[model samples]
Target chain A: MADELLEVTDLTMRFGGLRAVDALSFVARRGEITAVIGPNGAGKTTVFNCITGFYRPTGGGVLLTHADGARFALQRLPGHRIARRARVARTFQNIRLFAGMTVLENLLVAQHNTLMAATGFGILAVLGLSRYPVAERQAIERAREWLDAIGLTERADDPAGALPYGAQRRLEIARAMCIDPVLLCLDEPAAGLNPRESDELNRLLLRIRADGCSILLIEHDMGVVMRISDHIIVLDHGRKISDGTPEQVRADPHVIAAYLGEGDEDEVPAEEVVA
Target chain B: MKSALRDAVLSALVALRPVPVAIAVAAVFVGRLLLLAWRGRSRAAARHANRAFAERLTQAGKYVAPLLLIVALAVPLSGDRYYLHLGILVMTYVMLGWGLNIVVGLAGLLDLGYVAFYAVGAYSYAIISTTYGLGFWTCLPIAGILAAIWGIMLGFPVLRLRGDYLAIVTLAFGEIIRIVITNWVSLTNGPNGISGIPRPTLFGLKFTPAGGPGSFSDFFHLPPSPTWRAVYLYYVILVLALLTNWVTLRLRRLPLGRAWEALREDEVACRSLGINVTVTKLTAFAIGALFGGFAGAFFATRQAFVSPESFTFIESAIVLSIVVLGGLGSQLGVALAALVMIGGFEVFRALADYRMLVFGAALVLIMVLRPRGLVAGRTPTVALGRKREISAELVAQGRG
Candidate 1:
């Protein structure tokens, strides 16, 4: 727990009479890959939203303690502040890239708050009497580095909406990187990817983990969870059913029942996880 | 004697005596393009191409303004009464377009009652100048102040709505202003309007013979012509148009300007970003209305007459059409669109009855062709900074 970058305790959300997430809690440790997997509508996304400052959970708190010793209550921040101020970034389930904007612009916009902070005093900088130029240069440099890192330097001027689904997914990740997050939260980054794109995604996630930034991912693909996740959490009907290592989680009776058929869990033979 | 000065100012502007002023503005843009090109020369070929496009755009932008200014001054100087009237009308719409750009283009708020603010300005000046015997110069700011106050009042009720609802409500608010002005006859003289309103004097010199050495025509050794007065109003509005451009440009890069764009793109996103969307929207409305008011007051002083018939829904639509035709968010585009739309209308003065029909159809066609706009959503990306071109190979893969 002390090594954790994000800790959730008894998080619950009730939409009228429906309990979308029910008292779920888990810890995502620093410099490790944590994957949350469940069947469709198992509250995987609601958990992501609560952590990244989107939906306001009806109950419980999300406490994030960074490696630098700063602590934050993510629930208190709005989605924009969480992305811009708290340095917590996310990719969307339906892909919320600013479609009308160019691919390069999508990434630059993620650093909007930073550029704004430098230029908010405005005319002072235009008059050449402010620190805005320095800040602006830093933002451009950061955006350039991320674009290069993502290998998207070739299509910078193309519209994000025009990008094929797989590249759009990667561009969203690149945009998130431009925000320079301490914890990169992904909502089904593998959703629509072909096997090759999924492999690319796995490699990217590995590279991201190597950078010492923690990752919290929600995926339905069991193979992805087993191949990369250092820790795994499972959910069923908005309740946490299991939490453990990928091996331990696979062995858990409840998770086995939830994924495969309940009684047929014993019939499974050993097989390697493919990305 | 007084009319002679007006004519001289008109002729000088037509000749574009200060060509250096035009050249200087051009040089700054040309210099920026060259710098961008030089930096990109050693970089990727893609970078060079993008920089070159930007360079051409900057050049086009620089050239467009001075050319317009030159044409504006030159056409009237030839003593072509027809062109003089056309130029004056062009200046008025240019003013309207600049003002509407603040509300719609920069702020992303669609204002339908923009002409109501124009009416407010005209009536404000008309009432004050006639009843109180006040000068036009004094009433200009007063009209702007009143229009801004009205803008705030309108902004309050429509602040929460977004997209279509906000537009409808604002449009209704404009209609309300027009209706009230039309119905209030005792003070305003209603539809019969106010006449015999005095034209503004150049210092102590009126357009008439009184306070002059002789009759205005005799002193100037020319016929008694209001063309002298028309030319003065044209230059006055010309300077005002330039002032409008400067102020709008400065405002667009401000915190408020960014907020407006943010709100336009995504209001929830904007609110989440800690921008007070309400304040930004209201500021756009107020600033935009203030300009409308300024143009309106100028109209009253120039024409020396006022009526409710001048400010109509069609007028508002035309102004909005000018903004949309130019570009959703481009200031220069709006100005050009205004010139073409309004100037073209005057060019077809013989077809005045069908001019509006053509304009209405043109608006629909522009929307159909570019749903986003002529310059749809294209901001100066330099505001963000240099971005690497995503590789074409990936784009091919993206298509896959």
Candidate 2:
């Protein structure tokens, strides 16, 4: 469809004898939260790694369609170019923040490409000529906006590593957002978040979607997936078991079987099927 | 107070011998450690105390900097040629420390072959001036650019390397440059070295007495003395070192500088941020080499000669030690370190035979007392609202 922002077709990733992700195909629509949830080792992150160009998929193509109808084959591009040219920003499962830098500087670093261009690759910035000062102020303004949105404006001067764990998670998302990405991929952002923080994350994701950015989330939290996701894809043994709206995926027998297992279906409570 | 008086008496009794003085210092350091341990202080508490002490030292450094600059500016007034020469040596290393600081401090690239670029600059100046009869001013920028080109050349092959691998390659690169200079007799004159290198002139006015019409002494109507040449060379290096510091400080606030620090903090994070890591790293290498090149040209002109022996691996190690001792990425710390390390050596010249032993002992004592070097606190380049200091604990020791 014209609204389809990302298409992963027949994606296959193998590590020696193990097939981490096997022929997984899915589409993330524009301006929608597409949750990819499965049990541990279901290859959700491997799929993310492939799409973000962290890994070269063994087979098939991951295509991204930009707002103006430009197409990019993500797997062929370098890891950085995927983020630079294709505007795909991702947060790592194990928060890859510039821990040594200040919270505001972390966000500023995210806007590196923009500021670099404005600075004329540092020449004009050093010379104090051109539109660099204006660009730098605007960059700081954008960083300030995100810091306010994430409620980290007060601690903006502190080193990112010194922030509380939950604050760090929020800052990572804010940093990713500063890239002005069209597609934001988050890997287990709610992993260590408290219940209250998880709710805040859900609101943040919804706000991002409301702002017309697409989100591809790999989350194990059923509450976050079901409540915030517009579409859901279920993976089992690196294969797609179910794909549809939240209600449809929740109702699928295969997804229930994948979560609860075949013979132990009665052993677990029905309410705890996906949890 | 009794024990302190006793320790002072013992140190004073052995003041005539350098070895005993070093022993006294070591003994004092150990006694303090024992006292701290006896008080039942935890390692964390000890670390905290050390950091507080370092913070005070940095504050003192703030007040001392201008005073030191005044002392440096007024050195030639004493007309003591030995002190003037010593000042030149210390400032050369200071410039070199600042240059290597760009690669090792800010970028967190441990360059063990930094002296290679220094060698390139020195040789470039020596050859250009002596062979082509080019003036020192003409050769200075050319030498800097040539060294920067060599830096880029070295940077290309090692873009994928980091940590120990990067160190090893750079170490080998330093050796390679020295060995090439040792064997390349046709171009570099080999171990015989290049001699009679022309000294720098003040806009075509020579520093020599023999330049009857166009000499500094003749034009200014002053008595001709060799000390004038030494004084002029001192100012040349002083200006060059200050320029290096200025450029570095300005770059720290710019985008490229931020990118370098970010690259140091987390290379993978930098890549995901859409930063071209290759360009970021290469610029650091090139710029760092550029300063080293400037210092090298200055070294060549001041000595009026160039030799392969001057650019040995130990020179690289000494420069690297100055950077580490000063505290990585701290410019003031680097200058202080170079002063202490180079100037300290000169101060202890009376202890001839035992110099290395005392130097090594002092280094160990400093490392034990201030593990993070002299200045460990980092002030952010950009601040919103009031700026706060970031502790060394929060900063990443960029392995690359």
Query: Highest DockQ among the candidates is held by which one?
Result: 2
TM-scores for the candidates: 0.73, 0.93
lDDT of 1 by residue, A44-135 (tens): 99898888776999999999886778888888876666766567777778776656456765665666667667764555754556676687
Q: Chain B in candidate 1 has what TM-score?
A: 0.76
Q: Candidate 2: global Cα-lDDT?
A: 0.87
What lDDT tens digits, residue by residue, belong to model 1 across residues B245-307? 877776554445655554555555443333445666787888889999999998888777888
Per-residue lDDT of model 2, residues B1-400, tens digit only: 1122223223323543557567757776886678678656577787678878877887787787788789889999999999899999999999999999999899988888999999999999999999889998899999999999999999999989988778878888999999999999999999999999998999888999453678999999888888889999999999999889988988888788888999889898888878889989999999999999999999999988889999877788788878887888888889888999899988888988577556666765676677667887677878788767788888877878
Over 4 Å off, model 2: A264-275, B1-45, B209-211
At residue A243, what lDDT does model 2 achieve? Answer: 95
Global lDDT scores for all candidate models = 0.72, 0.87
Q: State which candidate has the highest TM-score.
A: 2
Report the error of model 2 at residue B388, Å. Answer: 1.0
Please report, as a value between 0 and 1, the fraction of native contacts recovered by candidate 2: 0.74
